[model samples]
Target: MEEKSGDSLATVLVAGAANLTIALAKLVAGLIGGSAAMLSEAAHSAADTVTELLLLVSVRRSGKPPDERHPFGYGKAGFFWAMMAAVATLVGGAGFSVTHGVHEISHGEELGNLTPSYVVLAVSFVIEGVSLSKALSQLRAAAGRHRIRPLRLVRITSDTALKAVLFEDAAALVGLVIAAIGLLGSQWSGSALWDGAASVAIGLLLLVVALILIQSNLSLLIGQAAPRQVETGIRAVLLAQPEVEEVVELLTMMIGPGSIMVAAKIDFCDEAGAAGVEIACDEVDRRLRDRFPGVNLVFLDPTPTRRS
Candidate 1:
């Protein structure tokens, strides 16, 4: 878990640096070229920079050890901050781009020299691609550990910092391409209509990404269940114990990144005395922890089996 957090920190840092540089370049280019799409791309990079900063905080704060006030630890802090970062993207990136694009469409500006805009878009794409590669490297490694495809892991993984970076960087790359296309269209047609339309499209793209990240973080913050495979493996571990006759009910929650809490009602064998039950509980706890390090908390209640 510590290693995962460390990877997330490095990824966010790289992305933040790249975005800061790209934002300045895009802003300058937008002003020189007088392109709405280019200006919208600038806003996108600025919001991404803010998102990365928040994600850095999320990664660091969430890694703190369990404390007296927070026995479950600060893992969910990552989710909360990631959700805030998404809101930033929604407001700063999507809102600005959409509103400006619509205004530009109605009250268009005469096109200026677009050479700088094209050059900046090309350069920004390369930088965003590098940041995205870093995220994909981490994602692929994590997926390999879980023996799942990278795409699938991204959807279900509780590591919101990583997910945010991957999504934002990918969007940055796409937005750059859209900006370049808009610049070309406006240059060809001698109208800002295409650039305005592209800005709106870029805003819509960002809106979708932000909503996805927000939903994912909100779900995890609300104590979403651990993945199905994790729950199944935990149940198997419990039923493997000789004294446990039946698993009456099992409940699990994702208490933090790379952490899960499990509670179950178990029916013990008739011949197993209280002493045997106690021993079994100890063994079960040790086994579960050893088998699934993420399963940090476990509670077992012995109950009589109900028959129809």
Candidate 2:
């Protein structure tokens, strides 16, 4: 678990650093070039920098050891911070991009210096790609351990920190492309409308990504069930034991990133005594913890077999 948290922190830090660097560059270029799309991109990158900082806080706080006050540990703290970051992205990245674009459309100004805008965008793209690639590589390795694909890992993996960074960086890359297109189109046609439109497009893209991240974080905060495969595997592992007769119910929740809590009502064999049942329960816990990295806790409600 510590290792997982470490990896998440590392990913977030890489993205955060890259975003901060680009934010400053974009701010300068936008000011110098006076392009609406470039300015919107600058605001977008600045918002991303804050989101990364918040995600950094989430990863660090979530790694704190469990205490009496919060027995489950500070794991869910990441989810809360992730939620805050999503809101920030929506307001700072999306809201401003759209509103600024509309305002620029009517009051378009001549782009003063296209050279700085072009250079800054190119540099931002390469850096953002590097950061995004690192995150994806980590996700790919994790997906391998889970026997799933990278895309599925992004969707189903309980690591909220990685998920947030990956999605945000991807949106950033796309936004850059849109900004570049807008700049080029406006320069070609000698009208600021194209640049303004590009800003709107970037805003809409960020909005969609932010909403998705919000939903994911909200679900985690509200308590999401483990994946279907995990539940099935747990059920199978229990029933395979000789002392176990039937599994009445199995419930799983992601208490934190890669930390799962499993509770099940299990019926042991009819001849199994209390002592034997205890042994069975212990064995079940052992097997589950061994089989799944996420199965941090197991609660088996031992029930006698009812003769129907």
Candidate 3:
């Protein structure tokens, strides 16, 4: 779990640095080229930069060691801050881009030399790609460990920091292309309509990604259950114990990224004494922890089996 947290930290740092650089470059190019699409892209990068900063906070705060005051540690802080980052993307990135784009479309502005815009877009694309590759590398590493496809792991994974960086970097790459096309269209037709429309498209793109991120983070904050396969594996381990008669109920919750809590009610064999049950419980804890490293907390309750 600590290793996974470290991976997330490194991923977000790389992304944040790339976004900061791209945001400055886009801002400068937008001002010099007077391209509305470029300016909207600048806003998009700025919002991504902010998102990365918030993710940084989430990663750091969420890794704190559990204490008496908060026995579960500060894991959920990651989800909360990641959600805030999504909000930033929505308000700062999408809202600004759409409104500015609409304004430009309604009141067209003269465009200046677009050579700088083209150059910056190309450079930003390469840099954002680098950042995106870093996120993908981490995602693939995790998927490999779990023996699952990267795309499937991404959907079910609770690591919002990783998810946010991946999605935002992807969006950044697409937005750059859109901005470049807008620049060319305006230059070709000598009309701002193409550029303005491109800006709107970029805004809508950000909007979709932001909403998806927000929903993911919200679900985690609300204590989503661990994946079905995980629960099934856990139950199988419990039922395999020789002293156990049945597993009446098994519950699992994601306490944080790479952290899970499992609670189960088990019926013991009539022949097993209290001491045997105690030893069995201890063994169960050991086996589950051994099999599932993410199972940080486990609770076992002995219950009588119901008569048929």
Global local distance difference test of model 1: 0.91
Q: Candidates sorted by TM-score, descending order?
A: 3, 2, 1
Give candidate 3 regions above 4 Å deviation: 1-3
Could you estimate the TM-score for every candidate? Answer: 0.96, 0.97, 0.98
Deviating ranges (above 4 Å) for candidate 2: 1-3, 304-308
The true-versus-predicted C-alpha distance at residue 300 of model 1, in Å, is 1.7
| 50-99: candidate 2 lDDT, tens digit per residue | 99899988888887889899988887888899899999999999999999
Q: CA lDDT, every prediction?
A: 0.91, 0.88, 0.91
Tell me the tens digit of each residue's lDDT in model 1 across 69-118: 99988989978999999999999999999998998899999889888888
Ranking by lDDT: 3, 1, 2
- Winner on TM-score between 1 and 2 is 2
Give the Å shift of residue 199 in candidate 1.
Answer: 0.5
- Please list the Cα RMSD from the true structure of every candidate, rounded to 1 decimal place: 1.5, 1.4, 1.2
RMSD of 3: 1.2
